[model samples]
Target: MQFTIAEIWEHTGLFARMIIFALGAMSIASLVVMAERMLVYRKSRSESRDFAARMGAILAKDDLDAAANTRPDKNVGHLGRVINSGLTAYRVSSSSKDVAVESVARALERQAQREVQSLKRGLGVLATVGSTAPFVGLLGTTMGIVNAFNLMAAAGSGGLGTISSGIAEALITTAFGLLVAIPAVMAYNFLQGWVDARSVDISESSNEFLDMVARHFGGSHS
Candidate 1:
């Protein structure tokens, strides 16, 4: 009747055991995603800051050609990509100022979308695991309670001990499910917030780059 881990597991039914295993897998998968996402975000942030500093110097002098040709690593991530896209468009566009500005604007917009999508990669897995893990755990709990009732009936006893094992088995799964789900949901929320913040940053940076392009091209054309 006592809730001992080993004893409870030993008495756990086959269906409950399977549910535990499934929960275990979900836990592992969510942890992996969390780790990978954190690592990627950290790396991208570092590389992007460095890239911005370097690009800032080049862009300060209004050297579009130099900025376009500056090849930073792929790790430079979103900001670098957006700027590079704009520069490339500017570098190869028609001589018409309006055409060049339009081309650069389009390129920046396209690259920003692509970068945002890239940042969102693997977030769905976290969302899925967070939302479903508790329900999956509940399935185990339900099965465990059913088994408990069956055990009590087979023993022909009304004592608490007769049904205690089943109840324990049922509750454990729910506990595990919550344990798995809570962190997944929290992590998902935190990561999502970070994404939102970064998205705003990218948008602002893109608009600034666009404004600079428009100013340079507008004056020349006028």
Candidate 2:
């Protein structure tokens, strides 16, 4: 089947609406993922910095309580929540210091994992959209092309204009799909890295806090 540029443009116009809709959905998802990840990373960085400063002061004064209380919420991100859990356990485990340390540490680890998962939320959806959107657009494009060819055959047109519209529609959808997928994939990867790094930072900071607590308490609750 032959296609003229003008004919292609007309055929693609029909699928343009659907492609626009898909692009809109993909854009919203990507923006949400980007915004949420940025917020989480920013908060985590601030908390980590504040906590580090507080930890420095506590170390300088050798004050366990001060260290424990120092910007407890501000010092840590979601990881702070996990550390707090361990700290709480440590305090309660005064009766069995040995067992308490182990149990509290384990509990904190679990909580940390949960927090990491929370930080990573919505990433999967973004990734899915990115990975599949192109193919979906391709499908639309293929359909448009097929329809154009069929129409050309039916019309027995000598001019390329007969199938140009359908072909154009097909290309447009494919292009739209790619445009949506690229950013989504990039955002998903960037956020995933940020979340992983933040999680590691939280884990390390929590470990330091736990160690300080253990050392001050003579490795076990009295």
Candidate 3:
């Protein structure tokens, strides 16, 4: 009637094993997303910081040509793209100051939206895994209990061996589910926070860029 950990898996029904395997797959997916997102956010933060420092110095001198000439660090920083878009708009627009500011503002807004979308990539997977993993485990547990009872019925006796296997299956699945879900939830929250911070930084950078344009071009804020 006694079972070791190895014996538990050996006795686990096919359906229960399938559930555990599915949970494993979900865990792997979450981990992959987490690693990928971390790398992206880290690069974005570092590049954006460097861009901000350099651009700040460039903007302080109120040099339109220099600001417009600023190049992104090999297409890393979102701020670089935003500034480039605005500057391009400013240069191509009609000589009217109002028209230039409006164009720049529109370009910056469009670029900001694109950057935010990029930052949000792969986050939905984290959310799905966090919210649904437990339910997947619960389904396994339920099926395991049912299988145990069916075995007991066929054996014509309520024996410990017949029931213990099912109980173990249920408990193992629930534990595995929690293990998978907890880290996923944590990762989702952390990454979401990182995205929010990046958004704020992008917004601040856009605002500062717009303000500089207004100051130099004699136009009100767009």
Q: Quick one: best lDDT, which candidate? A: 1
Give candidate 1 misplaced runs (Cα > 4 Å): 71-74
**lDDT at position 34, candidate 3:** 96
- For model 3, the stretches where C-alpha displacement exceeds 4 angstroms are 1-4, 159-162, 219-222
TM-score of each: 0.95, 0.82, 0.92
Model 1 clashing residue pairs (backbone): none
Between candidates 1 and 3, name the one with more favorable lDDT: 1
**Candidates' lDDT values, in order?**
0.87, 0.73, 0.84
Model 2 TM-score is 0.82
Error of 3 at 111 (Å): 0.9
For model 2, the local distance difference test gives: 0.73
**Candidate 3's error at 170, in angstroms?**
1.9
